[model samples]
Target: PLAAREASRVGAHRDAAGHYEVALRYSDALPMEGQAALHEGHAFECHLIGRIDAAMEAQGEARRLWQALGDRLKEGDSLRCLSRFAYLVGDRAAADRFGVQAVELLETAPDSAELAMAYSNLSQLAMLAERLDETLSLGAKAVGLAERLNRPDILCHALNNVGAAGQWLDFAKGRRDLARSLGIALAGNFQEHAARAFTNCACVEMNRLNLNEAEAFLDRGIAYCVENDLATWRDYMRGVQAQLLLRRGLWNEAATIAHDVVDDEATTALVRYPSLVALARLRIRRGDPSAGPVLDEMKRFLDKGMELQRLAPYAAVMAELAWLGQGDRAEALRLIDLAESRSPTRAVVGELATWRQFLSPDSDPGEIDGMAEPHRLLLAGDWRGAAAFWARIDAPFERALALLQGDEAAQREALDIFEGLGARPVAQHVRGLMRQSGVSHIARGPRQATRTNLAGLTQRQMEVLQLIERGFSNKKIAAHLTISPKTVDHHVSAVLEKLEAVSRGEATAAARASGLL
Candidate 1:
């Protein structure tokens, strides 16, 4: 039954629910103990897919059915599931009370896995309630209990929760703990566990400036959630990924990702809209010229966020946009000063400080400490670090912007770096700029994409994408490749449509995502 329920998580949600409904029917037809067990599984599947009201209904029926049958263990399981549901919906106080009763009722039961579920729920509740001190005090005990019983899911949750709660830990110590948690999560085959660990690792690595690794890990995490059909977290990770891209300087791509994420059905925008503001800030930063609509959209978003939830992050964004677009130095100062009045966590305080320094360059360091390791790598003239950071963030424009700023020899070097990483569009743009700068063949190193794994590309299509990536317009490409400009136009549309791109910037990103460039 666990295996079947877990299977439904992979594809066709309604199909999965149908299977559970059938399972529930059979359980009702079976003996007392069988009926008790079946309802537990049914309620679990209900909760997994966000049918919270249905879940609570099923669980209530399970409790009544189990109590009537004199099934103490099944009754306890239903109560624990209720506690999980309550905790999920932000009822930490009731969750803790129900959870303790669950453990007490199950003391003589042999279901170690079920027992671990309750513990995991308790651990998560503690984390969400900001009982970090209590979490640390109780976390090791939970780990010991889970390990002694050999419950992998409980162990995974504990390890990940420890890392989440450890955000307040000292930097060096936090990194070591998060890295260890990531290793354990990767070792586990559970998709949810892997997603949790990878996302946690992305956060730590972002703080440490390991941009390349952060991007890679986040991709793995987001992909895992998508594949696992974890819709709620899939939406949450979308916000995280967009923020990384915006920070890396891929404004349009960031906006596109933000566009999909902000509409995800399962999440509220308390965390999500701040991400939109970041993208809006980027549109403003790149001097997009046609950003008037987006700015108004952002202001409306901020206003809505303020009404829905009083989040400090949204307020920080008001400052960010002021700094990015209006150049209202005094206004920016006033906004940040106002932000300090709210409870400034690391994200608010750190980003508020960093964005200001990034723009002014001459602004006082204030207490930012330093850029994330990835940002530092890009800033410190490390080609490999810059490549890795930009790739993780998938920020092709930023990578190109830096390449454009480089001297001739440096441009060639940057070109080689992008080319090597399959950044075809960016490398093409660089080559076009180099030609305009009048330094085409005067440089060294291989810009040739060298026939590697063409993967899914047709020979003619590959030729066209390569040319377009190299910054050749339809006329130049048609002239060089002996095709009509009309044919070149036709081929470009084919490539963009096939790549699922909505714009040129998006096309470059799609190439990167597909490993085509």
Candidate 2:
């Protein structure tokens, strides 16, 4: 047992698990209390190493032993562990039952870490199940108890759950709580809790469209995980990174990350779900037939749980596919209605509402605070407002979606963006919409060019390419060309795409090699 403690203390979780197993083999020689404690320790070690079954078995043994010893406090704590293990395995019903039982048992016990953990676990479950009011209520109880008990681990755990849940309902309070949780975990060297804090912070920031801040958290969290061999957390953060990349219009890089996670057989569902969503969304945007298999696979995950985290993204894509006349409209609406029934905060509901509008334009998406600015504007029939907001954020895809509802000129601009982003289905849909509106002289896109010469650069694109080659900034290029900065951005993007280059320098090099410069 001492050896196991030392191993865990050093962050050697696999070694710690092995040492705990060795200690458990001779547990018959110890008292009942000692034996139960060893089992609990072994269970935690196993969990850290991603051995869910082993963790559950060990924790069950501990629970039985505590019950036999008439130790309700320890038994309740063991049950809490079992609840978490069940949730990780996608047995939500079993998780809820165990968590409730644990909380009931602990409620009669004295103020303790065991009881605090029970509250925290129940709160976390409530949050994941989209019971926002219950989550905050229970989370507050747990945090208050943990603070009074002066238990950093319990406090950090409670804070993370509450903070993440709070972001949906109260953005400012959520950020403060998450910041506090992160600080306490870091100061105490609680590596796992710290990693979780980093992941949650990044997720919230990404959803809020604060990409730079999200990237910073991901970088630090990934480094910490790598240093500590936290494979589970590392993979989970990588999934968030993939989603972040997708939101930033870097589909190629996003696809690479998402595909890697989806292809790895060893990944846990918690880590795989987000990556699957990212990949499926990307494939849908590109009009790939392969998106069918990806979405089909996602259906299996949806069967596991109906958490907003899972339901929102899947439904959003299905809503888009339905809008494109390639999916079941009724089913998409059903899913969106179900997600809305969860009473999600503004950001999530706002997204669902946007999709709802696409499918059923007359449906009301009631006023929601904290909705992403662009989506709120879009839902309110302020297409120009939404497009301007998306442009300010540099989110071209969403900007295009907003512009698609505008006048003919705006629709043409939207088509240009979709084409540039390689969103073939959306671009084609935009073209169809234009034709239906009796718009004429629609572009057929740029013509193909030979390997030599300017590689099919338009006069404007060639000018942008030249400025890029000369190390001119976008602002400087815009000034020289006497065009709006937005126009300059479009031309710069076109030049890079035409040259098949990933960066300004590479675009210039490709242009020079093709004798276009």
TM-score of each: 0.57, 0.82
Let me know the TM-score candidate 1 reaches against the reference structure.
0.57
Residue runs of model 1 more than 4 Å from their true location after superposition: 1-3, 6-15, 25-27, 30-36, 46-119, 128-131, 170-176, 179-188, 266-312, 321-348, 353-517
Spell out the clash pairs found in candidate 1: 208-373, 209-372, 209-373, 209-374, 422-517, 428-469, 428-470
lDDT of candidate model 1 versus the reference:
0.60
User: Where does candidate 2 clash, by residue pair?
Assistant: none
lDDT of 2 by residue, 419-440 (tens): 7776767877878879988999
What's the CA error at residue 88 for candidate 1, in Å? 4.9
Worst 10 residues of 2 by lDDT: 445-454
